[model samples]
Each structure stands twice: as structure tokens, then as C-alpha cells.
Target: MADEKIAKLVKRRSCMKSKLTVFGNYLHTLESCNELSSLQLLDLETRFNRFGSLYDDFDKLQCDIEMLSEEPDDEGEEREQFENQYYKLVAAARRLLGARPHQSSQLPDESVASCGDGRSGGFKSNCVRLPKINLPSFHGHYQNWLEFRDTYLSLIHLRSDIDNINKLHYLRASLKGSALLIIDNLDFKAENYEAAWNLLCSRYDNKRLLVNNHVHALFNVEHIKHESCSAIRHLIDVTNKNLRALSTLDQPTQYWDTLIIHMMAEKLDSVTHREWEEHRNTLNNPPSLEIFITFLSNKADLLETLQENKSKTKIHNKNSLDTIKNHYNQPTSTKYTQNTYLQYNTNKKHNNTYKKSLTCPMCNQNHFLFSCEAFRSLSIEERRQKAKDAKVCLNCLRPGHIETRCNLVPCKYCKKKHSTLLHMHEAETTVQPSLPVSNLDSFSSSTDVLDTTTPPIVLLSTALVRVVDSKGNVHTARVLLDNGSTANFVSEFLCES
Candidate 1:
């Protein structure tokens, strides 16, 4: 395992270092070449940093071809150099940007129109960077691959504002006539290819229709539905599709690791079958790795010998542990519980005194420290003590008194006590009977005779209102007002209003 890990690290390093070198060479070529314009240089550098150095050679060669094509009657020497540079650039592009085509369909026509409007930004515009193309000329940006990709997409959209159609035409013309456009990292959106492909297909008769292919179009998807490789159908011939995409590199590593771990665990299980209690009790301390491994190897040999012994036992009953002592050390049962621990014997008479004083009701474990159990799942003594402290009243089943003196019945007013009592005013038993109506003559005209005078009518008019309670029920009642009361009892509704 250690060797394998080392090998993997070394291989990863080698791949990265080689990538850096390839990019370094591409950068050198860009710097040494004198004929290229600075504006074009800036553009190439921007693209190089956005993608990777792998695309630099191809891009440079494309530049060289354009320069040569403009020369109507170029010198033989210059023409040869141009031809050589052109092929080199195409080869580099092919190497860096393999031919993985997009799989997803273009955005719907309505979506495209909406996005074309400034309001609904294009998918490319949403991105801040395009993933670096594998153009080895820009090695530094490779460290931040995702960021480079985001920035690249943003730049592409920004350039669309200047001369979108013309840029598209140039890219298409390059692909069709002289330049092989290698767009690597095909995992990007299909819209990117759609734009590039539209340009190429427009100039269909152009013999050098530069290829747009990937080594293998990856679908590293969160969900299978996002794998919209359907767009590839438009470009690739359906009958000969296998030629377009092929899996390279390797099968995923996780499957092998999982399989190895499971196999090791199964082997260990078969080789560690001693009775759990006996095995646990026998261990005075944690076994060293050497001791453990030796025990394992020995168990394996024993199991093999026991298999033979078992056949013999069918003919003659002689396969007991004692009978096979010389020939085998067969594993016993495999069950093991964490509570299995060693115990010491003490005199019953002395232990009895300790037991009476230390009986624990919670777990019914040992009576003293010396005789204590070692069950980890069971709470420690301190935790159990805290729990006992926090225990509820046994009779009331509330957090206070013991069963004998719980005092859980209703009070003198017949008000039942509760665990929580924010609405204690609603306690039914606390209500009192009304007083006798002896003072009514002071306020009323007469008990039997009717008084005709509208005499000093108090004219107390109050409002009744419906109130919504905490549980969302509406209740209605007339609120009273009295001048003689010590304090005003304002209804909650009136106060709120």
C-alpha cells in the first residue's frame, strides 16, 4: 500500500512537471517570434492565460499562416517557414485540445432571444472566467483551473460587444482554411461549440475544415439528467459514433480501493473467531501490531488444519479442542461485547457488608470500586449521580419530590398544579362566587316602582371585542369599566389598538 501510494504521487508529479515544460517552450516561442504584433500578442497572452500553454503553438502557427497568406509572392524561404509553422501549430492544437464534442443541445430559440437581449445575459456572460485551454504557453494559470475557465468565458462575452459576427467569421474561416482550432476541456457548455461550429459549417467547402474533437468527452455529472450529450448527435455520424469518443487514462480508482478493503475485512473476520468473552477477558492490555498479526497468521493455519480434522470427525468423533491440541489451535466463536472485563474473587462475608452499603438502583452493577463493572455504554458514576439529582418527582412525575411526599393532589381551591403555568389565571378552582346584590338601590331607580326621570344616568357605554388567542381561536366578551376600581383593567385588544 505504501509503495502504491508513492507510485501514484510520483506519476502525478511527472504529469504536472511535463505540462509545465511544454508550456514553458510555447511561451519561449511567442517571445522570440518578431513578426507578431503586440495587440495580437496581448490577445494571445490573454487566451494563453485563460486556457493553458498547450494551445499556444497552434495559435502561433495560425498567426504565422495568416501572415504568410497575405504575402502574394512570398520568398521561397519565407513560404517554407510559414508552411512548417502552420503544420506545427495544427499538431500542437490537436495535442492540447483533443476532439471532444459537446453533448448538450443549444438553448431554446426563445431562451437565446431573451439572452441576446441585454436583460437575460448569455451563459458565457454569466461566467467570470473560461477554463484554461490546455495551451501549454500559459502554465501559471493551471494552478487555478476553475478560475481561469470562468475568466475565459467572461472575456469571450466581452469581446462579443466589439464585433461579434466578424470574430465568429474569422474563427470559422481559420478552422475551414488553414487553422486547426483545438478547443480542449470539452466539459464546458455546448453553446461554446455551437458558436464555433456554426462558423466552421458556414464555410463548408473549405478543404482544411479544422477539426473540433476531444479525446473523450467527460460527463462528470451530479445527476445523470444533466448529462446532455445529445447535441453531439448533430455533428457526429450516428452509425460511426464510436470513432469520435473513446475512453482513455484509466478506470476510476475508488472501486478498486473499496473492493480491497472489503476483502481484507472478510479475511480478518474469519481469522478472529475466539469466543468474545474469553478473548476479551484474556487480554491484559491492548495487543501490539506484531502480536496481533502473528495471532492472525497462526489462526489461518489452524483453520486450514481444522478443515481436514472436520472430515475425520465425520468418521470418528475426535475433533474436540482438547483432541486437536497438537494439530490445531482453531478459532472459537466470534461474538464480542464491550462490557467483557476481568473480575477478581473476594470472600462472600466481607463482600456482603460492602454490597449492602453500595447497592445502586440505576444499573444494579457492583457495590464497590473494586467490584465495579466496565460497561462503556452504561453512564459513568458521576453522570448517573447528576441524572439522579435531576430526576422528577415519582408521584407527580415532575422534576422535584420523591413518591412518598410528592403532594400532587389539587390545592384547597381545587386548582391542579402543573409543570408549566403561564395561564394560571384560567385555573377553574380559583374563581369565587358573586357577592349579594344589597347595594343595587343606590344605582337603580327602585326595586318595584319604575322611575320616569332620566335622572343622572351614568351613561357608561363600553365596547365588546373579539380577541384571537395564542392558539388562533377568536373569543368575544364585553369589557367592563369602573371608576371606583383601584387600578384600570385595560383589555389587551384596546391597548393594542
Candidate 2:
């Protein structure tokens, strides 16, 4: 790898100093002979073109020498001299050739766009610095080589003004993984740039490898499980990109339209596949790749349109409902409020009359059997007998129904089809017959021992709380408030829901 950096640093000055002497000789000949024959002009242009090929060996050899580590004392003068001759050589060729100029690296920086205003030779007024174009990166992937090659050639390698050092900097920066390692051992000298660049190109620029990579990519296109606008677009984009790459590889993808379509269609959702089949039947000629892609694009657009309209309809309905609710919920006029008050009182009076008519079967009290003090005072057996005699629900003590047909909840304690007050407690435990002292150990071995090491019983506070569900229906549920608990919890029924 070259010991390169991305800054505009001038390194390996001694190499250029040695090359300057040779470049100066050419300049001397051009300037010394003002007029030259066709042969002489040809020689000058040919030499200029040759030097521009960037095949110099001196930069590599000279940079490795310890003596050339620092530039010569007259490095400034030498560089200035080189720059002057560089432009002079270009001018001399152009002046002699009259109309045709021999191109070398690039034309003397004249044709290159500058960030400065011509008059000031500085940055132009009102200029906005645009973000630099990010170089395409490569990581030894055969599929990514062509893109990186084209981009690097256009931006760095082919540019004449950027020195070999800067080109090496850019090449190194753009590479990663195995690609970077190939050129990573080279020194950061101007001459090593070409060698590093060549190593990367030779390794990655394999036509056969690139073809295989893209072919595999095409075969591995993701399968869409369900039809949606974005899913269809993704399927279409991936198919086209891979096919385009394969076409560039001379795979005859154009002639393989039917085969390609069949392969790609299998990756589509069932609905889209059926649609493509039905649509292709209407075509007069055999279905082509372009036609298939166009069909998918159109379907994607239709799905998008449908989704947008659906969203708009839902929004409109929601707004209309909100507007109607607002109008109804607005404050009523005084007369309307008076009428509402009278209606509420009338409903209250009607409810009181209904309750007054519920005469208790026991003691003829003006209350339901369950609410009556006399009825509650009865023992469980008596209550059961009275409910049976009255033909009322044993679970709710309501008239005209049996406990089996009643919809009321069962007893909270015993979970039986009867009111909790009427549930008979289990018979008091009876002591087991005293085991013989000799058989105590045998008896203990036959029975499972109680787990004395069980977790301590925590005393948690609870309250009957009313909570509204997703449907806005209020439910009365008991909630435990335990400060020591790390998380809030709900019943299994709520969690599943």
C-alpha cells in the first residue's frame, strides 16, 4: 500500500527534479528552433504524448532512495521552471500545428473549470460551495468493479491537474476490505500510485467473475409474499437492474425475454403473477421483458392510487363524524336545557315507581328478596328453600327463573350456581384417627410432605376499580396495588385480547 494521504501535499520532489531536466531539454529544442519541418513537429508532439502516458520508472526508483527524502534547496525554482516550460511546450505545439493541438494528460489547465472569477483569480462572488461528489467505493466485490472503475477514471485517474500522489490518495480512500489490502503495502510516493491502482484493476476487472455475480444476483431476487405498491416496485427495480447488468455482460438477455420473464414472475406474489398472465394474453406478439416491466410498473401505480384514495376517504369520513359530534355536543339553549331537566326528573320518578312495586315475598316488605333485611337474616338452608318456593333464581334471587337458566355470575368464593350467601361452607375438618407411634414414620413416608420453604405471603392492597376497554365499555375489575412490584400486570384474558 502506498503511504498516501488525501491532502494536496507535494512529495517525491527529487523525482520530479530529475524529470525536469529531461522535460527542459524538449522545451529548449522547441524554443531554440522557432520554425520546424513536419518531421520536427511530429517528433515534438509524439514525445509529448509519450511522456504523458505516465509510464515513468524514475519516480518509483528515486522515491525509495534516502537522499531524496527531502526536496532540493532550489525546489521552488525548479517547480516554477517546470510549470513555465509545461505551458510553453503546450503553446509551441498549438502555435505550430495552427488548428490541431496534440492533447497531453489534459490541455494546460485552460479548459478545466475553475472555482474563481477570471478577473479576481479568486473565488467568485455569490458562489456556493457544493458538496463534493462521493467517490464510488469497492470492497473486492466483482459486481461493483465496473461502477468504481468508471467513476474513478472520470474523477481522478484521467484528470491531468491532480498529481500522481493525489490520485493514489483517492484510490486508497475509495477501497476497503480485500481491495484496500492489495494496494495497502505500497509506499505513499507519487510513483507507487500507478502500481497500486494497477494491482486493484487487475484483480477486480474480471469479465467472467462480474457476469457470474450478476447472474447469481438475478437468480436470488427476493420473493414478494403479498402484493403492495412498494413491494411490486422493489420487485420490478431489482429485476431490471440485474437484467441490465447481464445485458452489458453480453448475456443475450434481449433474446432471452421469455426465459427471463418466467424466472422473475415466479418471485412475484400469486395475485401479481396471475395478473401478468392474463394481461400478456392480450398482446399480439410474444410477451417481451419491457412489456412485463411496464405491466408491473402500471400495477404498482394503480395500487398506489387505490391506497391514496382509501386514505382520503377515511380522513373525510372521520372529519364528517367529528363535525356531527361537535354540533350535537354544543351547549343547548336555556329552553332546551329546561326540557332536559324535566325529562331527567321524569325518568327518575319512573325508576322509583318501578322499585316501589318490587314487594319482598318474605314479610311483604317494599324491596326485593335479596335486598330485604328479613330475607338476608335467613340461614343458607332457609334462603335456598324460600328461593325454591318462590320459583326465583337461586343465583340472583330474581323471580320467574331457576339458577340453571339465570345469566348472573356464580358465587365469587365457591364458583357455584348459587349466591355466595347461600353457599354452604365445607364441613369442618375432622381430626384423623391418632396414628400408632410405631407406624408414624410409615404414615409420613406414604404422604407428600408440605413445602415449609415456600415464598412468604405478601400483603397487597386492592380496590374495585372501573376501567374502560377499547370499545369504551366500562368494566368493574379488582386491581392489586403492590408498590414493591417492578411491573404493572393485567389478567391473562386482557393480555390475549
Candidate 3:
């Protein structure tokens, strides 16, 4: 009798479970609908009322099965499964009917929805505490779908507290380009969220294509052209990312050490590769992938450290150019007296001290012999003797450089490069005593004496000529023309001018 009752109750439970699945399907169809028709609403209400009644019936069946069934464990699990499906369908139907349960609001400090393991009773907390959501974006790239999907599922899709319409909003916000076009025409309503989501998932959820793309990326990582920290870091990062992605695909990566090492080694620039080879040879055992990766990481660190130190060295030990510029950039009053004196002397022909090399021969003063009044008072013979005694340049009468290299103005006394005080004046020629005039007459008569009968002299006033020198300096010069004289002479005043 007990077995018979148990069998009958078990059969009823199975029928109820089947009925619940049909209702679940109906609710799902309703949930997917963008708008409910009047008839659909009527049917939904009627079904919910009936399903609402089944809750009690299901409770009663659980109690009866627990009491009558011999195998409590199996029946208990089946009963729980049926109850879970029953709750979801009921909750969904009621929600669609605009009758969400408010029992959750009654627990002020209620335990959080235990969805940490990714399985939940589809629990939603009133005023749910959410983490700071930083949404990920997509642009219809196969390479990006996996990351976007995983992140969106965690941050938005799996969040039960957000409604389908809001989740749809997040989805739309995150999408662009062809990815967005997949669902762009859909209406922004709760019913359309699932359809839009499904379209996106269906298009981008191709695992075979993803695997091929990631694998291609693994082999196609950009080659390192130089041994730099950033480039090495990029190479390491790209390889690790692709390898991790391959590992996620359940690819045989554990045995890929030698193959990956060979491929990655070929990608390294010559210097880095040579260093890596040296490191590899130093190891007694054939290095594993971890060891190889560690070598690259350490290399990158050392390179980065060296680059930083080089930059610091440049910053600390500045060049002399700026210092020299600053030194010259100062105003005359601010500079040392010697610099000012040199600059001032460049503009004017005369200098106060002339130079350190200049020293008067007679008094040993810091002036040229020509510039000294006491030296100027001496005769040319005395000045020449003084200059010879001092071993100075008799031309400029200055020390240290010869007459050929002298830079002073020419002597005003003679139009020569030597100092005026050292210039030698010429003596006027005598009448040759007229060859004792009578003898000259006899000699001139013998040679038919062509005007060797010296012409009678006449005193002529000094003639002045306006002369312009090569330096553009114009001078009023006294010109004396004498047929008897073989040379022309200019006065000291004209030479100085």
C-alpha cells in the first residue's frame, strides 16, 4: 500500500515537473516579446493564477514524497530540482505580470545574494551594493570579443539587480562599428535586450575562429628590431598574452617550451639574441620557458636601468657652452676689467696700457717708447740705442713682436711702420761744392755738359695737395717738386693726418 501511494505521488510529481517546464518555456517566450498582446496578457494572467496554485501543490507533494519514498536522497534531489524550476517560472511569470515579490525588501540586513560561484537562485537584492563598474568596449573585432564578453558578463550581464533594458543600454554603450550594427535596429526595451544580446553573442561567439585568430597572433608578434627595454618588454608581453590565450584554449602549451623558445629567439634582434645564447649556454640544463622568459625580463630591467643612469649622467654633468655664453653675455660693467679693456681697445687705435708686452726702454714703464714723453724728448739716435739695448722692436718700439708683425699705426715722422720717435730723418744734399764750380763747368764742357750746368735755383712756396689714403682718410699734404731731387717728400703733419 505504501509503495503504491509512493508510486502514484511520484508519477504526479513527474507530471507537475513536466508542466513546470512548459510554463518555463511560455514565460521565456513572453519575456522575449517586445510587447504583450491583450490575449497573451489574458493567457499569462490565467497561467500565473494556475501556476500560483501549483506552489502549494508542489509543497504538499514534497512533504508527501519525503514521507512515502523509500529512497529519500534521490527523491530529495529531484524534488529540489523541480522546486527550483518551479520557483523561477513562477517568479518570472509574476514579474511579467507586473507583480514582483517584495519579500526581499523586508530583510534590512539580509545576507547577500550568494552568486559568487556563478550559480545563484537568480537572487536580486533590493538596493544592491555594486562595485565601481568600468565598462569595457567593443568594435566588432574577433580579437576583442572574448575580453569584452567576459568583462561585460561580470560587470553588467550577470548583474541580476540591473533590468534587461538597462543591461541593453550598457551593451549599446559598449558597442561601436559593426558590433553595434548587429543590434542597432532593435527597440530599446526589456523584451528586445535578450534578442539584441543573442544576436551579438551568436555573431562573435565563434570559438574556432577565435582560436585561429589568437594562434595567428601568437606566431605574428612584431619582430624586435632593436635591443631596447620597451621593445623587449613589448615582445615579452605579446608572446605571453598569446601563449596565455592559447593555454585557455586547452592547447598543448606545457610541451611548447622548445618550440616557443626557438620561435621567440628568432624574433629577437642580434645583440639580444647573442646575449640570450650566452645565457643559455651558461646553464647546465636546457633552459625551460620560464627560465628563458626570466632572462628576457632581467635583460629588460638591466637595459631600463642603464638608460635611466645615462640620462641622469647627462643631466648632472652639463657642458661648458652654456657657461661660456653666460660669461660673455654679461654687460661691460659686470665683466672683469681686462675683458672690458680688450673690447674698448678694439674700437680705438690707441690703448691706455697698450698691452702687457709693452715696456718703456728708458724707464721700464708699462707704455710704448713712443708713448713716453721722456723717451720722445730724446734724439732719434738715443731712442734707437735705447730700443737696441732693451731688445725691443725698433719699428714699433714695443716688446715681444718684430717690426714685420707690428700692428701700430705707421710713424707720422716718416710714413713708415716704425714708431715716430725711432724714425730717422734725412739730411739735405750739398751743392756738391760745384765740383768746385769751375771743375764742374770744365767737366760739363767736356761731356757737352747737358745742363749739368746746374740750373739757377728759385725759392718756391710749399704747394698743398688734398690727398686721400687707402683707408679713406683725406689729408692736406705739402708737396715739394724739384727737378734736381730724385725723391718726393711729405711733412710729418700730413703723414700723421
Candidate 4:
């Protein structure tokens, strides 16, 4: 039984060394392929798993050799040979596990030799832990399927560290909404993560369906008038999106390029289309889809800039015009000066006509009584005293005896014997005194004299005159000076004296 055990141990050690050699060669080949195909990735994963199994077998063999070395009956030479074989096995196992042959001087002696068992202290050599992969999230949308599939498979499907059993959990955690629902409905006991992934692909990864949807979306893009920049950006985004989808579907670049260019051209307005055609005509070679998209983007930017500049210029011009109009419409002081001069001339002419028919009482000159410089220069009280001494009737402002003897009638408004100038209240009614037909004709003729022998008329002007009696007594009498009187006559009492 001991020989058989030794034979089994030796055979297992040989197998582990041979497996390690094969694994090393395989790892070299994998590293050589700069980009690994899907088949190569699967092969690599299989090789890594095989290497792990071999490592477990090697660990058991090392334990068996250690057990064999403890047997007392074994010679020192035989024990040294077993130790040598065990060390060789350890070296082979380390190479298979991709561990560096050299030990760091910084690591302690126990840690460096820990791999003699199937562990590094508490850590197991058989359990190869790989870095956890963070899967890309998916919302089950058809558009996101392509990207999600690429990331999901790259991180999970080709990795050896993640077991098939734990794949379902990672897959579930990486999805949400409709995607989660699709996986949740699967029979948990029977269906694996692969089956769930297959279901997702069948539903969302229909290449022909995706291509058609993307093509339809690209064709239907429209440019908004006010949102030209956003519209152009959206157009480029959709174009690139569909192009990438087509490329993923293995559609020919030339075919999809022509199709996309035509679709984009159709979506453009007449002006932009004409401009695109002009640009195309100018190019010696037919413009590629990428070049066309770039040109359109540039054109959109230029249009937006031009529109902004034009709006600013229009506003500036409008403001300038308004300012000019305001400047033109404003009244000038020169116009006010001319108006003042015309008003002063008109008032002077009116004053000259008034002074032609009047005489100053103090100077007996052909000027207004108030226009006499001597009288005007006097104080208010002194002027009043001079007017009183000259027998100026204060009521009618005429040269005569005092106001009591003056024959001035009361105001027509108040019907009281007072000056109309003294009447304060607004007149409720007015009556024009009726003049005789003879007086009316005489006044109308312009050359006829005014009658003096009429009853005292309200608000009419009157004056006082000095008279001499037969006894040589001086008496004052009130008399009305009427321009309409044809002949003047004294009273009967005065005529008899």
C-alpha cells in the first residue's frame, strides 16, 4: 500500500508538471493575440479553469509527499529525493498559478513558504480570486442593448473567477425596470443566468429590427426653426447612433454611408440643401458621411451667429433712429425767442393806438394818464393824492369833480350803484341796455355824434363840470359825455339864470 501510495503521488506530480507546462504555453499564445476573438476568450477561460483544477491536484500531491516524508523507515537519500520532487512540484504549481518565481525581500519567511500547503496562511491557493467586475447597467431599452451586451459579456461571460451560479445575482443587480422583470419571471430553480441572457438577446438584440428602427429614427429627424442648433446636434447624434448600430449589425460602411447621407440630405431645408449641394460640387471627391455631418454642423453654427449679429444690429439701428428722431423733434429756445418778440410788438402797437386817443391830466399831453413818466415815478399814495386834487373821478377813472358828484351808474350785474370792477360774484344773467333806433343808426354811421340827453345807463361813464349862477355863486353839476350827441344843451334852470 505504501509503494502504491508513492507511485500514485509520483504519477500525480508528473501530471501536474506536464499540465503546468501546457498552461504556460497556452497563456503565452493568449498574450500573443493582441485582440482576442470570442472563441479565443472562451478557450482562455477553459485553460484557466483547467489550471485551477491541476493546482488542487498538485496541493493534494504535496500533502501526500509530506506524509510520505514523515515515515521513519525512509532513508535520508529517499527523503531528500521526495523533498526535491516536492519543491519541483511547488515551483511548477506557482508557474501554473501565474505567481512570480522570485520572492520579495520584504515578505516574512513564513509567508514565502506558506504555499507548501494548499494555502498562504489563512488564504487558499486553490481558490483563485479574480477582481470583481462592475457590469454596465441596463434598462431593457432596445437602444441600450448593444452597449450593455458588449460590456456584460466582456466582464462576466469570459471571466473564470465568477461561477455560473453567482452570475444570476450579478446579472439581476445590473438591470432594472423591464430588464429586471424579464429575468425575474424565469424559473429560478431551472433557468440559469445564460438562459436569462439568451432571453434578453432574443427580445432586444434582433439586428434587423434594431437596424430598421435606427434607420427610421434617422430619416424622421426634423429641424426646428428657432432651435436650429439643438436640431442639428440631435441630427448628428441620431446619424452617428444609427451608423454605429449598422456597423455592429455587420452592415457595409459604403451602403450605410450612402443611405445615411441621403436620409440627412432629405431632412434639410431647401436653402441648407442647396448649400450642401454647392459644397459637394466644390469637392473633387464625393464627401463622406462624416465630412457632410461636420459641414452641416459648421453651417448651423454660422447661421446662428449671423442671426444673433443681425438682431443686435437691427436693435442698434432702431435705437439710433429713435434718438435722431427725438433730437429733431425737440423744441429750440430760438423759436421761443421769435414768439416772444412777435408778442411784444403786437402789445406795443395796441398800446400806441390807446395812447393816440388819450391825454395825461398832469401834462395835458397826447399820452395815456398812467403813461406820464412824472406820474408813474410817484409812490402809490402820492399818485392817488395827485389824482384826487385833480378831481379825477375814482369810479370812472376820468378827470372831473369828486366821486360823490360824478354821475356814474351802478354795475349791471349787481343792480347796485357801484363800479362793475368792484363786483365780485359771477353774474348769473346779463342784459344789454336797449338804445333808441336813432342812437343805433347814429352809432352805426361811424361819423354821427352820441346823444347826451338819455337816462343814466348802468355802468356808463359820467363827469362833473363847474357852473356860475346869477348871484356869482360857483356850483358843480354832473354831465354825461356821449359821442352820439348831435347838439349840446344846458339844463332849464341854468339857461334861465
Q: Which number leads on lDDT?
A: 3
lDDT of 4 by residue, 1-497 (tens): 77888877877777766666666566666556556565654454345444545656666666677677556455344445545654465444344333332222111111122332322322234543444445689997777788888888876666554576666776777889888888788765424778998888888889888888776777678754443656677788877887787788887866556667888887776777788899899989867887998998898798789879989999999898668656666466446645676767755654574455466777887764555777756654556666667555554445533455445575565656444333344322453444445444533444233322222343333566788888888887655454334566455544554
Which prediction has more favorable TM-score, 2 or 3? 2
Clashing pairs in 4: 449-483, 449-484, 449-485, 450-483, 450-484, 450-485, 451-484, 451-485
Backbone clash count for every predicted candidate, in the order shown: 37, 8, 1, 8
Give the clashing residue pairs of candidate 2, or none: 1-183, 1-184, 1-185, 1-186, 2-186, 2-187, 3-187, 3-188
For model 4 the local lDDT of residue 253 reads: 60
Give stretches of model 4 more than 4 Å off.
Answer: 1-134, 187-191, 269-271, 300-497
Tens-place lDDT per residue, model 3, 299-333, is 99999999999998886655554565566776663
Error of 1 at 101 (Å): 34
Superposed model 3: Cα runs more than 4 Å off: 1-132, 319-328, 331-497
List lDDT for all candidates, in order.
0.36, 0.67, 0.71, 0.62
User: Between prediction 2 and prediction 4, which has the larger TM-score?
Assistant: 2
TM-score of each: 0.16, 0.43, 0.42, 0.36
Give the winner by TM-score: 3 or 4.
Answer: 3
Superposed by TM-score, candidate 4 places the C-alpha of residue 123 at a distance from the truth, in angstroms, of 16
Q: Tell me the TM-score of model 3.
A: 0.42
Whose lDDT is higher: candidate 3's or candidate 4's? 3
lDDT of 2 by residue, 36-65 (tens): 665775576566555543324433433343
lDDT of 3: 0.71
True-structure lDDT of candidate 4:
0.62
